[model samples]
Structure formats: C-alpha cells, structure tokens
Target: MIQGDTYYFAVHLSKYYPFSKRVDRNYYKVEISNKSEPSYKFYTIKELSENNKYIEAVSIPPKKEGYFLEREEKHRNEY
Candidate 1:
C-alpha cells in the first residue's frame, strides 16, 4: 500500500467464463506512485506473444484503494 511499491497480479479468465475455452489469463504489473493524481497506475506488460488471441480480464472488486487490495481480497475469498 505504500508509495513506490510495485505489485503483480494475474487475471484468470476461467473463473469468469467457465464455458469459454478460448480465453486465456492475463498478467498485469502495477506500480504505486504519486506521479499521477490517483496516486497509482496500471501497466500491461507483454508476457505472451503479440499474435495470441486472448481476452484480458481482471476481476478486482470495487474499492477506494487501488487494484492491489482487490487482488488480495480475491485470493482470500477463494480459500
């Protein structure tokens, strides 16, 4: 939660679209900083091939904080 902290998150498409076999999970790298007005920003790093046909999905819960908390809560609820 502190500024200048970077967090990594994975978006699993399987949970949202169980029936869809084409959707692949996406990974997002986020950094916490005060450079912007929101105090945070999200960056999409190219992990997979550019030609890969995958739908990027992020299931972060609604919150006043950044996606970091939402990602943490998602894992907590799963177990």
Candidate 2:
C-alpha cells in the first residue's frame, strides 16, 4: 500500500465565531496544496466551511491485499 503512506481525513463541526451569526452552515469542498518545492495536494471529500471547521489527517490500517485476489478468483468461476 505504497509503504502505508495513504492519507485519511477526519471532519468535525466548527465553533461559532463572534462576528458571524450561526444561522445556517454552508459547506464547500476545498482543494488544498503545499505550493512549494516537493509539493503535494489533496481535496476534501466532505464539504467544509471557510471559518467554521478544519481538516485533520488521520491514519487507518490497510486491509489485507490478498483478500482482493481471492475475491476476484471467486467471481471468475461464476461467469
């Protein structure tokens, strides 16, 4: 799994700021990037707001790769 370098994201509801009224929540998908040398980029799967919330990087264990191969073999016999 590319040496387990895959990135996962976690989202949370943001606290209300003093100036902005908490009428309704607006959601947007933001594209973030490290605009420098050795750059990287990623997009948010969930909608985000400008002021309210932020994204965090979370790690999850990768599943067994061998399971995929076994599933594929079973499907072939059904045809």
Candidate 3:
C-alpha cells in the first residue's frame, strides 16, 4: 500500500450459491479518500472485464487441505 505503487489482488470464490450468483448487470465504483487529509474522491467505473486494461484474471489451482498447516507444523517440529 505504498504511495503511487501498483498492487494486484486476487479473489477466489467457491462453488456456492452466493459466490456463483449471476448478475444481469453489474455496476462498479471506486472511492479514494485520505483520512489524514480529510478529503474524498470517487469515480464510477465504466467497464470491468476479465483481461482488461485495468484488471486481468489468472487461473491458479486450488490449494489442497493442510497445505499451509503442514509447512507450519514442519517448522514447529524443528524448533
């Protein structure tokens, strides 16, 4: 979250009803505000698409069970 730095975030959704819900039309907006300066700015997103200039989707395999825990457990045993 450094100033003027580009950051990318990835979100994964499970095969659940709420996550897989289809939208007829979607509206996107972004709000920019500085709490230290007490100012606010907002912009309406015209379009949000996959592999667009602003956003791109990348496919990644889902993690299996104990993926994180196994690594932590191994390190803990060493200590």
Q: Against the true structure, what is each candidate's TM-score?
A: 0.19, 0.20, 0.19
Tens digit of lDDT per residue, candidate 1, span 19-45? 122334542333322332222332234
lDDT of each: 0.37, 0.36, 0.34
**Model 2 lDDT tens row, 1-79:** 1225444342222334222223346522223222211122243333332324332212323266578678888898787
Best by TM-score: 2
Worst 10 residues of 2 by lDDT: 32-41
* Residue 65, candidate 3: C-alpha displacement in angstroms: 6.5
Off-target runs (Cα >4 Å) in candidate 2 are 1-62
Task: Give lDDT for model 2.
Answer: 0.36
Candidate 1 Cα misplacement greater than 4 A, ranges: 1-6, 15-44, 55-79
lDDT minimum window of 10 residues, candidate 1: 47-56
